[model samples]
Target: MAANGINSVALPPKDGFASGPLSPGEPAAPGLPLRSPNPLTSKVTSVLSTSYADAEFRDALGLLDERGLANSAETRRQLRLDIQKEVIQSNGDIITEFGRVADQLRRIGTTIDKLNRSYQEMKSHVTAAHKATSSTLDEASNLIAQRQDIEKKQHVLKALREHFVLSEDEEASLTLTSEPVDDRFFAILAKAKKIRTDCEVLLGFEHQTLGLEIMERTSKHLNQAFQKLYRWTQKEFKTLNLENPQINSSVRRALRVLAERPSLFQNCLDFFAEAREQILSDAFYLALTGTSPSGQEDRSVKPIELVAHDTLRYVGDMLAWIHSATVSEREALEILFVSDGNEIAKGIQAGRENDLWRLVTDEADGTPEFDAVKALNELVDRDVSGAARVLRQRVEQVIQTNEDTILAYKLANLLNFYRVTFSKLLGTQSVLLESMSNLETEALRQFRSLMRDHIATLQGEFQHTPSDLGPPDFLQESLKQLTSIMKTYETSLASTGDREADFQPVLAESFDPFISGCENMAKTIKPPSVSVFLINCLLVAKAALAPFDFTQKRVEALQSRVDEHAEKLVASQYAYLRTESGLDTLYDALAPLQATEEDIAKLRTSDALKPDVLIAASQNLDDFLPSALMDAMENLRHLQDSKLTRDITEEATEKFCVDFEHVEEMLISADEAIEQGQTNGHAGSQDGPQSLRALFPRTTGEIRVLLS
Candidate 1:
């Protein structure tokens, strides 16, 4: 039981003693001494001996004894049996332990299942609680929103009752009304009433008027309700002693309605103008005076400067409003212009004479600021040129008569108004130009359609043949007619004037027709003309129509002309080749001919033509076309001499050459091999050379030798 007793002990149990003879104990050894075995070692030894005690073990032991000693065999056998029995018992113990582990695992699984069920129940409760809370929150939010909406409606109703002036009869009528009114209708009625009340307060209604009576009654009630407003305003102004001229002027304007004299109304406007001018002049002085060598305190205020400042501010506002009103309510403005011409004229005259220089320069006798005057002059010149000119002349005359500084300022103010009016006229002119441009675009579209139709008709004429003429003659006539059409297009284009409104459509129609006719004629010809006439006509049309800018429509027409002509030329060339060389039949015979080549070459190689022959035939066909046609093609190519066209043609030609070279090489190689075998002595010999003629004698004999 010592920690390291096994390592310190001897390898074998020596004399069967516990440390050999039990260290002088009382018990004497009988046959062998009892050894104190290490617990771990004894367990291992028992397992090994038990496992080796069977018949299989006996045989192994016998074999070991045969190789060595038989005397020790019995002892070994006994030890092996004991060890084997111990191993069996150990294995049984392991099986029992495993069964206990399995039982424990089952209990754990059962506990886990119960826990999972509880957890699921908890999760369901949590989910339900969350949903309920969310629902409660949503309901609260909805209730709050409803309350807010109600508050807003109440506020609107209160504002309407306080602001709107309704007569006793009208109020009674509203109450008696049984029909249900929507919110939008109520809002509209409220807004209209508010606007009418404001207008009545601002414009001052006559006492005899029904509207005045209602507004007076409403004002009386409002004054009673707002009795503390004056005290509030006084408290607000206490901390700031600055007088707000704008507020004072607004009050004055409202009160002016009570005074019915038109002259008094005019006086009020004059007073407002003077007050506004004073404020503006003060602002200007405040800004510039600090920057001057003379300090801010040195800047002086004058009556003329105040008048000039007010005039400029008023003119600026008037100009802005006029600009907006002209666009939004042009008819209303026109009525105003007719009814209030004298008032407007007088205002303009006063603005022109205003001494703006005194406000800007802070000098009473300073040269009148002509900037506003100049601006007014420019505006008047653009919008109402005649009126502006007359206004300017009158201003100069007035200046000469009154050399009064006030009159000068008034004239300057009037000039500013003229300038604003002129600017509006210029803006109107721009709008007009934009409309004209759109109209031109639409017109051009219509013209293109008309041109395309005419061209289609001309194409028909070129394709159709007369019954009296034979096929060849008919084709020739068609070609002639097409050429004539081209000539007519050229003539029409040449005579068309640059300024003529009808020129574009006429020339487009004429030229487009000729182009289509030429294309159609090409289809009927033996060889395509590839004429430059169509291109020439297009160029001429472009030139004639050049005076009218080269719009998208014209460019499209030109592109169409080029495409049609090119397509027809290619088609005609293909058709001519088919008719002259019977290439169509060759295509059909290709598979059969290939089969025949194999048969003939098998029997006699001499009969089979090489691929070179087919290549030469194709080359000869290409070369056989009329020189006139080639020249025409060259001329047609030259027609695309412009930078844009040159790029297109070069690319097309390069691609065509590459494909043609590939086809030529394939045909040539095949023809050359066949031809060499047929003519050469080495191929003609039966057994001397490999020959297709020998292989396919039947096919070689039937095939006609057409090339030679």
Candidate 2:
């Protein structure tokens, strides 16, 4: 039944199955094979037929057993036949069910055959439809192409029939290439002109593109040209013609030759103006930003300052070479050196910054950027200042080391070195002149400072031992050095034609301290010694200052003061010598001496000035006749016959004479007494008749001794 569900029949093995129709020799149908008989079936059949009566088992049951056994055997036979019938019946049922299955299978096979046929027909139809579609598409494409061709041909034929059809004379006109033979030729010429005009218009478009390309190439060529020119300039100007005496004129002549023909520089001017902005921008960016162009690492390229400076110099030289170059090249160079698209004026502008003038233009008023002379001067200033600074440092070092003396010649040597080096590197006449001027000023300043310090030190030295009034060697030597320096400075200035070489002011200024110092020192000494040494110092100072014309008056003034001091000292000494007490002592001792013999004997033994003492004092006065004070007085009188000393001496002398008159009066009284004695006839005794002459020797001797 399970096999019969799909309409297939199962039969015994003796029968063969068939699906559609069975052939005689073919294997059984695709359905399950027919069932074959097994041994169990046969065993069951045998068991059904078996009986105990057939052998000893039947006898062992006795009569009842025999009867039962016979009955059983019969029953077994019947059962065997029943079993065989049942077997046949089962076979028949199986074959019947198998037939039913075969019929159902046959129907299923027929349906499958029909479905296969339908599938084939459907496939064929699909193929046919695809072919028809492809053919239709091809036909459509071809029709469309043909339609387009037909339209194009129609359009062509229409044009040929209407617009392209030419008259015989028009065709002849087209063939004409030269002078017109007739009206047709003239028409052809007119068309030709029109064609030319059209061609020219078209060419303008072409030229626009081509022109830009040409300009690009030309720009590159110009750059390379400029580069070569710049390199050449660098080489040529490595040492500008500063070595040659006529370098300025030579260069100017050379530039003038170029400037005489301005047309020759037109191309250069155009290129320079066109390229300057870009080049300056590039240089500026590179200098401040350290940037380089794409793919280039030349950030260390030289700055534009030198390029601008050199370019301006070249331009200036050219202009200066031709006096008319200013008027001619002003416009060209204005464009060339323009910054910010604004033209820099020819001269420096008051409102414009100086740095702007660094790229100065030729039209500038005062100092053109191209002025080589001015450039040389500016460079010289830098070099000289640098040299002066270094020389000053060296001089200061020398000053520190050799403070005792001035380094005037050494400074001259340094100045010479600076001049030579400047000339070798950056010299001109103007430069040298200016540099010397600066050198003189610097050297003088430094020397003056050195001298001032020396004088201060000398002043200190004088102040330390004012009584030691002699000029030390160092002092004299310093003065000598100062004189030498002044001379050197003056000579240098004179060589440069400098009219302001007067150094008298410095001399007087430096001497001020010394003069005041002497006076101060003089005041500290005692009177007599003060006069002595101060005079010597004054004379020394006068000698020291004698070289300076400006200091003559000052020296004379010092001499005058010295004389006054001497006279004052003298008067004080004379006053002390002739004091009333002093004269009274003399008078008391000598007044009692009479012309009598006994009084004269007493005067000889008295404490009065003895005759021998008087003689010695007189001799000493003679020795001191031309005293130092007197000499100083005479010297002062010679310097200026001023009455200051004379009045002082006369006043002091009158006081002295008054004191001496008392001594003279005592002598006179003595003389009178002696005379009276004589007159009274008392002269011949041993103690009588001693005259005043016995006590006093010479007439002026006593007065001279009193004065001493």
Candidate 3:
């Protein structure tokens, strides 16, 4: 029945009596007591024995048995059943009590929860009330503070009106005063200063600080008013007459007032800036439309001149005013003046490039025209590099248009003018020099091209004619052209006064092809023809360049080029003269005569000598008969003192001598054979001796072999 699953009672002793009586014949156990006997006692005892695990119930049963509750069997049975029913009833009572206690606890928990939620709600309402009360108090405090501040200001205003009084003179002078124009101005200014000091002292400490601040604000306002008047006066002053000296004094007074204010002095710069802007706009318009100040289109006034004149006038007037006003403003005035001048310069440069370029190219010398260019030069700070660039472009254009030597000469003359005219800048700037250089380069390029073409024509003509000799007409004409071209180039250079200019490099380029052509022609044509062609080229080059002092190196180079080919031709000619027929047939022709004396004698009669032997014998002399060979030999003969020519000539002569010796040996054999016949058979051995030397006809010339 308790929470621990047991009754709240002590256990019975092991010897205690059962809850029932003993049977009639059954005795109680030893040391255990039992007296009562009832019919229900038996059942009670049986229940107690069965439920003995409930020790407390068993103990209570023992007490009841000892108290005579069970005496008979019927009574015991009755008691046993009665006790069993009581036990079940007691258990039911305990379970009912536990359910009642749990219900009570749950209801108490619900009541506590409701009380907690109600307390939270009341706290929230109290907080809102407190916030409203605090807000109301803050508003009341703010209202009180504002009322106090209003009262204080009123009191201060009342005090100021009562005590802050000035004299009539002071009151009148306290207002903003214009600077005086006459001798009384200093007296007025002194009165104004006294009025300001007296009012400042009249106000108390707090009011004095406040009054000082107010006065500062008033002073700034008055300063602004004065500056406004000064600007207006300055604007009007531009058209003011100098004849009215009083107006001049007034203007001077205003300027002095403005100058005294260091803070407001910078405002005058704004006026100057406005003037500069107007000047720039006007200048730009004038540059475009060539319009005068009166709005008429005036071509007589050039844009540059207009810009310069306007700028100078503006600067001069502004500076004169500034200097007349105060010396202290010079530094500031000059800065603005120069800045305005720079703006005007930039505006003048706004002229169209074509227009400017036309001015550069114009040859007219009218006063307006000359002044315009000069003014433009001054407007651009006297730097004409920009115009120089235009001139350079013009030179390039001229070069592009012309190609002939005559045209090139004309272009050179034009460039010469540009050079001399612009020579002042030539050393300082490369534009002119570069322009001249480009002209020279272009002229030389044209010359080289012409020379190449002419050389090509000469080469073509040579190919068509198929001759081993010159002077070809095409070569002659080309040489003449080349000479003319060189002369033209020299003249151009000379006119330009470029004393050190060398045209040889261009000539080298032109002559290089000619040299190569001659070399190639020499390979196929006779050396004499090639020699003659090269000689003409060399002579023409020399003659054309002879007059120029700078052309000596070029002339030497040309000679060297010609000489290179000339040497090769001479060696070739030597080889040509040394060409000998094959001696095989010649040897065979003399073989029979070598075999016997009679064989040699037979040949004298029989024309059995092979024609190759005569041809071979005549080979040395035949090599000299061709014009090319003749030329080669002549050249070699002239140069024989030189080692190379001497060696070549000596070698050629040696070859000729060897060839002749072979023929002479054959002749000696034939003569010996004829003498043998004269001794042996006494025949006609002299049809004048009948020798091989006699076999060679007289017209062929007697061949002598000089043994070396």
Instruction: Score residue 97 of candidate 3 by CA lDDT.
Output: 100
Tell me the whole-model lDDT of each prediction, alpha carbons only.
Answer: 0.40, 0.46, 0.49
Model 3 per-residue lDDT tens digits across residues 319-361: 2322222222222232322233443223223322112212233
lDDT string for model 1 (1-708, tens) is 111122122123444434322333456557863554454565566566654546555555555455453445465455445445655787799999999999999999999999999999999999999987997889999999999999999998776565664545434332333322233323433443464567465445455364565567655543422222222223332332123222332122222221222333334333433443343334433332332223445434432223435433433333343343233222322222212343333433343333321122334564453443332222222232222233233334433443322223333333433333433443433322232233334333443554454345445466653222222232343334333433333333232354234334544444445545545554553333333444444554444433343233665676677567655545444444344432333333332333344633432332213334444444454454334234323533444435424443333334333333333333344445557665674655545333322321222111111210
lDDT (tens digit, per residue) of candidate 2 on 350-440: 2232222232234346533344334323333332333233333433444344432346344643454444444444445533345444654
Q: Point to the candidate with the largest TM-score.
A: 2
Worst lDDT run of 10 residues, candidate 1, spans: 699-708
Q: Which runs of model 3 end up more than 4 angstroms from their true locations?
A: 1-394, 409-426, 430-468, 471-474, 489-501, 517-708
- From the highest lDDT down, the ranking of the candidates is 3, 2, 1
**lDDT of candidate 1 at residue 459, scale 0 to 100:** 51
